[model samples]
Target: MYALYYTPGAASLVVHWLLLELDQPHELRAVDIAAREHKDASYLALNPNGVVPTLLVDGQPRYEAAALAMLLADRHGDGAFAPAPADPQRAEYLQWMFNLTATLQAPLRLWWYPGDLQCDDEAVRRGARARFEAACERLDAHLGAHGPYLLGERLSAADFYLTMLMRWSRNLPRPAHDRPHLGALARRMKARPSFAELYRREGLEEWA
Candidate 1:
């Protein structure tokens, strides 16, 4: 069984959702970020980064939300949530996964925690917001051209990651969902039964 260290609706949401989607047996360990519990020595031992979504895989601690998502889908999805390595779509699947994490999710960190740079928060937020929106526009166009899902008709772990990122944009000046294609993707993803179970477990209702 896996033990997942998480905060409700944080990066851990994707990991938790995947566990539910795959029907994996697991346990949740809530980290109180506001109380600084994630930074404690005990928690830090499991996750040096003090971030949510640190998963204990086979009793070994592992972190990084995207990595965990890909790992879980590959291991548990039985070819449903990830393409087989020999499949032609494998390359495209990896491409979207990396793009979502590196291109899209990276800017969101700065958008949410601009103070980390010790620069003018507003400047950081503006630049990050612009970068994020540009990525979203490109993704929207890609979906418009070739999607009902990122890899055409198949639902992959990357779509789950994208849906989480899109939800993060709910408060942005121009949310990612404002893009027609992305909005449709989000609606499709959120309509999954696992997503509702995720919300119920995570106690999240705002995005729903």
Candidate 2:
């Protein structure tokens, strides 16, 4: 059986959600971050970076959320998390997923480090916030243009990643859910039964 090394509340949430969506059987091993378990020598051998959400496949480790999502999608089927590579919408789907990881996630990170960016220096923090806010604005605009989901109207992994990031964004100096469309999208995702089940199983109180 596959064993997923994860923390209670981390990017592991995405992998956990994806695994549930795939209906795959796997073991959930929570690495206590508070105890520095992830930094242990044994854990380091499994994941050199000492990060959570490392999937142990056949006893081999596979990391990176985007890669894991794509791997799961491919392993599941053609029309599930991802469409066939030949499909026209595949480009847009992959684009949105990567955008969540690359564009959206960075700003969300800064919310946890406002002063570290030297927020006192208007230029530093302002520039960081601007960069982050711009991404949120672009995401908001994309959601408005696309409507219901990140890709047109079908629910996809992109939505999951976006929803996860938005959950983080809510605590930011600038929250994405402040936008009507973005807020609505998050509400829709949170209301889904599948998401609720995953939350319950993980004992996650709230998603957004």
lDDT of 2: 0.78
lDDT of each: 0.94, 0.78
The local lDDT score (0 to 100) that residue 168 gets in candidate 1 is 92
lDDT of 1 by residue, 1-208 (tens): 9999999989999999999999999999999999999999999999999888899999999999999999998898688999989999999999998999887888999999999899999999999999999999999999999998999899999999999999999999999999999999999999999999999998999989
Model number with the top lDDT: 1
- With candidate 2 superimposed using the best TM-score fit, by how many Å does residue 124's alpha carbon deviate from the native? 6.1
lDDT of 2 by residue, 7-91 (tens): 7657777888888888888999989988999999998998898877799877789987777777787677557778678988889
Clashing residue pairs in candidate 1 are none
Q: What range of 10 consecutive residues in model 1 has the weakest lDDT sum?
A: 101-110
Candidate 1 is scored at a TM of 0.99
Look at candidate 2 and tell me the lDDT of residue 36: 97
Best of the candidates, TM-score: 1
